[model samples]
Target chain A: MVDIISQGINLPLPLLMLLLGGLTSLMVGLLSERIGVAKLREVWMIIVSAATLTSIYYLNQSVQKAGVLVISIWGQLPPLGGCFEIDTLSIFMSGSIAVLGFLVALYSISYMEKESRLTEFYTLMTFMMAGMTGVVMAGDMFTLFVFWELMGLSSYVLVAFLKSKWGPIEAGFKYLVMSATAGAFLILSMAIIYGMTGTLNFAAIADNLRGAAVSPWIIALFSTLVVGFGVKSAIVPLHTWLPDAHPEAPSPISALLSGIVIETGLYALARVLFLTFDPGMFKLPIAFLAVLTMTLANVMALLQTDIKRLLAYSSIAQVGYMLIGLAAGTTYGFMALFLHIFNHSMMKGMAFLASGSIVHETGTRDISSLRGIGKMMPVTSLSLFIALLGLGGVPGTNGFISKYHLFSAAFGSGLGWLGIMGVLNSALSMAYYIRIMQVLLGSPKEGFKANEAPILMLTVTMAMAAIIVILGIWPAPLINFATSASQSLVEGLSTYIGAVLG
Target chain B: MVPLEPFLVSVGLMFVIGLYSLMVKRDMVRILIGVEILFNSANLCFIALSTQVPGFVDPYAHSIVMMAIVLDGTVIAVGLAMVMNVYKHYKTIDIRKLRRLKW
Candidate 1:
């Protein structure tokens, strides 16, 4: 029985932690009402998130092992069954997701204190975290899509958590429509790929693509995949739902949405383009999309007045920068891309949390209504200031480091025009961030109270703010990790082929 | 066996119609129906694709699509519920009335 169970399933430590977290959260949620364990729910969520992060941290230590740690539920091998695979890329992403998820859960404790559906919020958040972790660790396309829906569904519900508010309901409805359409595109693409390759495994598909003739059908498959993933990443022309969805969500959820959810989409796009398909075939289109996304998003962001909406557009712009790196299709490009993921997460996470604090104190998200709030909420204001500077790619922040690498990669890939546009957009983004800062710190408006944000919110904002600065100054460790992960992604194609075919 | 071409074409037509309605319709419930049409079209496409495989119907893909369909139904159901709430709060189903998002 042991041998049978161990046949094709190799469970890694990090995935085990995630699975444990998911199960524990579900169990607590189910028993919370009966056991009258209201306080225990929060404790359980924090413990699960922390344990998941700790396990992912340990997994990062051995990520250079260069192959997948697979685990089977039904004890069956690939091409015939499903399993989980923890690689360097997966572990790195899983670690970051765990970290952000833990922080967001921490932030949510105080954020949702007055809300009645606290248990539902924490329960849904746990499932969402589990889904994201699953997406990162999935070895097969089927597993990725399954977890993708899991995350998407939970997020849709969470977006409308305040059901009484028409804004959230409408926003959630629009989000569902867009997301469902994207899912259709994804499934159709997967069907086409399966039709051609006869397998749903990522490694298998890569192997098939390497030797197969490039037909129009394959091109169509690629196009569908791009559109599917592009919508999730909020790429141009498919980004209408984002500006509505982000601000409509609760602050902590918005932080998660902007910080990591969209990045996961970009990660999937990069994985498919670089890992499963030939990069040479998609280079020009990817570059075009990158340039267009960066330019359009910056322009839209400049026209926004609501603080969260502005940040939402800016998040789309950040995804554009990462796309530039991925489009370059070099090991260095992937490194820049991965590094920007971390940088963007920290910066945006801080920005959203700070915005949440302001909204909590001021009771509004209008940029114009927030005059002189910096003096009112010093800690929140300072955190927002740092995050704004970081977001604008100012010196002494993580954003500058990542954006610089991205520009360098763009130039190195001979897309110097793209690099120039990226710089222009970075500079353009500064106007909005600075404008918000000016309004917050400039002069007191009548009827505005001078009050500090809740301690929980302030702590979360300050923590992310410090990390942004620290990562900016001493980026060697992060640079090395991203570099190695990117190298593993670029170099693992051969190993991947061997693994899938064996 | 029945011909698959007409079924495939009908599915494609349904998808196009759904997109058309979703883009043009202002009523919330109408848009929901449009979403349902789009989802059903995708399911039809999947079922057709499953039939193309040689021997077995590719149980894995079929099952995944089945799950996706269920998810789609649930999502639309949630959307309709939200629309009901929107009507209660705003007293209208016209999306133009929900102009809170406009700059």
Candidate 2:
């Protein structure tokens, strides 16, 4: 038999890592019945994370060294079986997803100690991880939709995993309905695109649609895609499910959802819009969403009493900031957007996990009741503090680097107003971060005693915080990778088209 | 000839009705049914659109619609499972009553 990958590339291993996660999930229920599922989950998650990281790293190296690798099953062409386009962008995203997944999985071992359904939790989470990897790497629209559903399905289950609680079940239902509606629009778009271009492959669709005349229906197609994807990404008007869904899930899962789920939606949107339509026509609408999503989410964040809810709103706002870069439609703007995606993932993951440790120890998520909890749980509080600074775009945190570039890139790309709005929003966001700190460290509340979280959780949070600071100061490497990715996207459909069709 | 207008018109009307019920329904079960209706409408679009192409049926659209149905079924199954859990906790699946996770 001939080798399957067209470009002599190795089998797309990141996808393998993801699929393995889903495959292994079937065994988790049975296995957990016999052994300590939590501990077993930790081991399994570590292995999955290692594979993910190794796969992503090798994928990145290959893209950087060789070229964009298109891997299809059984050597089938694009129109036949689904294809995976391993490029700088996909690998960059998978790298963050894998790394955060490892840390969150590690932290969840300790955090979810008292929670029931260990195997189910880990299984859904792994399935979710696999789904994300698939979405990022998917070269065909149908493949992306498949993985998108995989991601959405697992998240719905994970959100409601704590089924006994009324809050989780309620939130999970709302999330399911909203996301399912979004899924409907997604398929609706796919059906129309199939009807229009008579192809489903991303690159092939791009080639066909670009040559076709721009009709009114094309706008409808784009609008449906935006609405479908925007709901998943939680862009402004469609973002109601996010705050509820993010806060109701297990903290580690919340970290994953907040950190990467919405971001992946945006990623898919960018990829599809770039592949199929004339992107210049769409930049203004994207910029409009960017402004609206950021400003509203930040204002909401300032009003939250629950720490996790606060972070959740803040996550939506950060998506707004990332969109500013995306809307700029410049090479640097795109690079900055990807960079912030990675940076925000680390910062938000750390924040959610650190807060999880606090909630784990103190049995509360209210910032008011948890006065001086920072003193009680020193490491976690500190991590939360650093994560907050990163979130607020403090000078020495990783967030600063991305946000700074984002604003500059916006202005450079002639969206000076967007840059100004971003700065104002970042400034507006700082108020809540300060309030969190005051609650965490300002004064001691009587009769509230909580110790530090477990060693495992502590190690993970601190490691992420340290990374935030390090990346903040020395972001050269990430910036380099992001620029290359952006360069490829900005260069347009030629390279991507050639790779897929051959 | 499978006259395309009627199929498109019916699918469009059903989609609107499903979305309307989905938005307006207060009961969770009703909401789930609304979702199912929307999904079936989408499936109808898929199948109906396939008929427009000349000659034989489009296998890709058929396969895609089938996959979509399976995926849609999975979503509703989970939705129903969640509905069961909701009823277990609150003794009702009324969407208006479940006000726990707001804001």
Candidate 3:
């Protein structure tokens, strides 16, 4: 083990963090029930989260030493074997996921203690985190698909954690149906690509794509891939399952679902689109899809009464913004997309955590029932307000910076219509966000009383809120990171192709 | 004209049957069976593809298909567990009544 660690190809520290967390959580879960010790579960969760956060910090530092780290597991070569490749792009995502994951774990301590299946909940959460991290760091198609399924399966189980609740069970069922169909489409696409190119590694596919003639079959493969990932990313038409699934999930899991997991799907989409096919194949359809996704999601979000459902719709809308960035097929576009990925994770994670606190205290998730909650749960309400504003792309918030860059990238790419649609959606999202605030701050309704969330939850919310503000104001390092990560994606293609085919 | 071999015709027929059952089946248990049939059809297709590739059965695709079968088995097992839970909760196997998410 020591030799492996010392001689290891430069692995991103975040991946190790997630692996350790998942393993520890699984061990603790198995033992905690047998030993009849409850506190040990909490202790294990905290230790796992801390270790993940520390590893993320170390990963950020290592980014300076290595432009990007590409590591293979079990010394496996690509195309025929699975591998993990860490670049600046993946490291940035892993870091953001770790930060939010740590806070959510802390929040879950107070939020989930009263529940009977606490150990199971923590174990699934850790596994889900590890899966997401794996998806981002995956070096090849097979690895990405395997980790994608891991993330999807864990989330399906988590969505129905409240087994007795009809809402959660039905939501989980719908999610499973949609998710399984998507997984099948993904498998079919992979098989076709392998049949055509005789290799499963992404880099090999790209090389074959350049010299190989485009056939109708290739188009079918790409379309199938779009549908598969589109469902996970909650693109317009494919987004029906999300509004139900996100809200039905526990709030911490909702944070993960909305914040990191969906974005990981989009990240994979972008990586595949940019790496596997020429820019010409993607230009028209992706831009058109971006426009449709943005417009449709914002329109649907306007009608939602449930706060979590509204946010879920907004999550789809945000994915559209990232799609617009990626469709540009430029370094600036990749930068904008990744920047939004980080910012959205922080802002949405805070929002979901705050929503959890609200539900914890009020025992309801309806926007109307949450009326005057600002006066009762002042801290939670304030953090939520900040999150909403950030989500709406208000100035001095991280959302604003990322959205601004995305809009600029769209315009630079000459897709002014997409830029306009994105701006319009941002304005439209504000309407629902502000309405929720109004309800939260308004007069108390009959049978309503003041209550606050637990201190641990409050601390987690405040920490995320602060990071959102800080990153918004001082975004130079993040901007640099995003730019470099985008460069790595665009510049490393030839090397990747050569490495695989040679 | 392309020759329609009996084995190829049977594979196609099995695929259509499996797809039809998957779409028409109301019972969760039946749906799992349909999925199993689809898996077998796909396995048949894999064998066909391997034969077309000349010498040895393309070990790469063969291994991938094997892995996929294992994965499908696990997924079906989980689906069965979920079906058990549904039976305990709603006391029925029909999917039409599971309408908690409808707008």
Q: Which ten residues in a row have the lowest lDDT in candidate 3 chain A?
A: A1-10
For candidate 2, write residues B1-103 as lDDT tens digits.
Answer: 4778898789889889999999898988888888888888877887888877788677788888888999999999999999999889988878888886676
Provide the TM-score for each candidate, comma-separated: 0.94, 0.96, 0.92
User: Candidate 3, residues A102-189: lDDT per residue as tens digits?
Assistant: 8888888889878887777887888788888888878777778877888887888999899887788778776876676677667667
Every model: Cα RMSD to truth: 2.8, 2.3, 3.3
Between candidates 2 and 3, the one scoring higher on TM-score is: 2
lDDT of each: 0.82, 0.86, 0.80
Isolated chain A: TM-score per model? 0.95, 0.96, 0.94
Model 2: lDDT of residue A491: 80
Best by lDDT: 2
**How would you encode candidate 1's per-residue C-alpha lDDT over A1-502 as one tens digit per residue?**
0111236445556556655666666678668867886767788889888988887877666554435455554577765676665567887787778889988988988888788877778878887887788888777888888888888888989888888777888888888878877887787787777767777788788877764567888788888899888888898878888999989899999999899999998888898777666666777788888888888888888888899999999998899899899878899999999999988888898899889878876778888888889888989999999999999999899999999999999999888988998899899889888899898778886767868978888888899999999998999999998887787688866665565456
DockQ of every model listed? 0.57, 0.75, 0.39
Higher-ranked by lDDT: 1 or 2: 2
User: Candidates sorted by TM-score, descending order?
Assistant: 2, 1, 3
Residue A456 local lDDT, model 2: 94
Q: How close is candidate 3 to the true structure, as a TM-score?
A: 0.92
**Which DockQ value does candidate 1 get?**
0.57
Model 3 Cα shift for residue A450 (angstroms) = 2.9
